[model samples]
Target chain A: MKNILIASTSTIHGSSYLEYILDDLATFFKDTEEILFIPYARPGGIFYDDYTKTAQKAFSKINVRVKGIHTFENPIEAIRNAKGIFTGGGNTFILINMLYKNNLVEVLREVVNNGTHYLGTSAGSNICGLTIRTTNDMPIIYPPSFDALKLVPFNINPHYLDPDINSKHMGETRETRIKEFHNFNTQPVIGLREGSWLHVKNDSILLKGKLSARVFEVEKAPYEVESGTELNGLK
Target chain B: MKNILIASTSTIHGSSYLEYILDDLATFFKDTEEILFIPYARPGGIFYDDYTKTAQKAFSKINVRVKGIHTFENPIEAIRNAKGIFTGGGNTFILINMLYKNNLVEVLREVVNNGTHYLGTSAGSNICGLTIRTTNDMPIIYPPSFDALKLVPFNINPHYLDPDINSKHMGETRETRIKEFHNFNTQPVIGLREGSWLHVKNDSILLKGKLSARVFEVEKAPYEVESGTELNGLK
Candidate 1:
């Protein structure tokens, strides 16, 4: 089976975003020696030895190879050589920038289609959507180029919501932002609130998270939904 | 001379958002009998009465009229005949809904052209843009179509910020969301941080309110901008 781990953070081996998927990751890569790491998403900023070290420590404990893609001068080579890919989150815009700058978006798409195991979180997860319209980051930072990998048909809005923070001072809330998105296009946007993820394996798509995801269809009211459901069915 | 008060709140009567603009509002419409309220931006919500009443009380001392547009069966006539217009804060999507529903978006645009003293706060201020993309609300529940008033070009991302809040549970921050928006569009979006409002009077467009606002341009980096600056120059 193709193994891809698109994680928000690198190590479910310790404190990581995919803690919910640790058992699944371990079970899938039990015989694997190394897991390729794509840190290209954070090309502009300095890595403070924060999550990278954490991911290294966790993967080392499990005898999984942890390779950062930065070492390779060419990003396409790094993606092409990987057995299974693990995408860690930083800035999706930055990630797409590096990917497009090196022209790796197409290669990555092809790799995934070739039945490579794909695992992603946060920024990594965002690339899986049709578009990146739902992201909550500043859109004009010129983080390389704003184009996404286009793995899925809709945009991904990661780290979806915080119920306690008063959205008044911060701007419009998440729900309001997406509704505005809907007004511009007829395509439906899948709003995956935090703690939730969509898992695409083989021909199946599964939804994993605490809260039910919200889906917005143009000219229709937004509604709560779950994963494992087909997006094609809704549109 | 045409008088306009673009505030962050309905009542300079109170609230931190009003402190800087209160005296100016009172002085601008010094001789006006009352301010016409446009609650149409917040259609079908339960908060209109309380919102409209607050402004009524604030202007009550000045004997200013605070009548909601919905009160008149023909809100267009009310707007066309008004001495001044004050748009209160509420869900922008809701407000946009009412604007589209009543076919009053054009009417309001015409009213502005007719030189009616206009005061729009929050949601009201949002409609001033070409598109209300800057609002910090949920995207799920759309009220109506949001074409905005076209008073200005470019989309606005209001109440923008980097993730200062350390809460892990709150999903992705606003920065992440707008970043997603950037990826989808070739046009640069303006990230108007809190305490910032833009004033459009005659040919002069001034960025009012606090310190400096952040500006995001497509395929470029986001930069900090100051008040009294015009948005037209950037586009």
Candidate 2:
């Protein structure tokens, strides 16, 4: 059975780093005293060690220890031995690239599927989808492939935003981008807005938090899925 | 001499298709009666023929005819003999993918460099830069490479928008995305707002339109470049 907490964002506006979701994280990662952190996402181009320290500081509040995957002699071995795994968010391109480069994609997926506790935020949550095609981040780096872990049956558009009706910006909205994704893909996409997340346990997935998630399927109108809605059928 | 009109978008907020830039295009492509349109970047998954028809309808108002590159027996020959070239906006990933698939990247760059009258809007304009790394579109498809025409010295962010001061969205802002690009790339980037364009002639490139464009360079503060300012120095 897979136990995962995938969040749209680690922090909300006017909140400290990982503050809003820390309580939930504590509950999801209860039995684990330490988490193996993958800091390759490197938000704002932050150094990996610095990013790890940041995560450590946040986890310390809940009396948990954080260790970076880079600190291990073998990342593959680290994933195999980790009590829990957490991937922070930044640039999805770089994160997925590193996952392939380090040859951890297979092992990471294996451990997560073998019932290891897993947590992903933003770019981290994105890789849990069928593909990274739905990501909103810039292509700052090119990965060998757009394929992800497929931990979830569908793709996730993290930090998804609704169109501003009053704005004059002509760029495609979140909904428009996903519709375009349907042009070349058949997988369903979940527009996971900030403050919302998906709780995946075994074969079941549930939308949690205060907001409703926007669900998009091929040739069908996008509709809202209320909080606590079971998403396994979407898979 | 290179003659190019690179626009941020084909249409403005309330205008008809290409209405805002049609007059400038008419003056820039003064001697040309027909344009070879590259419909590879099919906006909203529109078919090539349908997208070309849209362009034809818009160009007809200016007494010009539009021919899609796909209509030709050989797209390479079509580009080589084109009197004027226009590449419209769409998903940049798919556009670049088709450019590579058709082996048009090198030939297209050569013709445009050899003094062909050229016009690009949004995704089209983005390719005029060093790479498509700065594009805002979803990665609906993967290209063989992120390398582009290098027609200009830097990269371009089409339909560039400023950070919303009042919005609560947690996604990275336009400025932040560009800054992230600088982490892996040294090239400067021009954030071209809607209605703004770059008029490239020979060795000089001038910012043109009603609004100012934002210029971002590595290790320096981003600043606004007024319309009509010569951007050759930026190169």
TM for every model, in the order presented, reads 0.58, 0.97
What CAPRI-style quality would you assign to candidate 1? incorrect
Taking the tens digit of each residue's C-alpha lDDT, what string does model 1 give over A1-235? 3334333333222345455666667766676677677775553434523555655666665667777776667768878887777777766556776777778889988898787777777778877766555555432333443446666656677766534454345345567677756655556777776556666666555566445777777788877776545454544
Residue B186's C-alpha lDDT in candidate 2? 90
The regions of model 1 sitting more than 4 angstroms off are A1-17, A43-45, A48-51, A143-146, A162-170, A209-211, A227-235, B1-23, B26-235
Residue-by-residue lDDT tens digits, candidate 1, B91-118: 6766787788788889888878668888
Once superposed on the true structure, which residue ranges of model 2 sit more than 4 Å away at CA? A43-46, B43-46
* Tens digit of per-residue lDDT, candidate 2, span B136-166: 9999787889999999999999999999888
Candidate 2: lDDT of A216? 95
DockQ of 1: 0.14
Model 2's lDDT to the true fold? 0.92
- Residue B141 deviation, candidate 1, in Å? 19
Distance (Å) between predicted and true CA of B177, model 1? 10
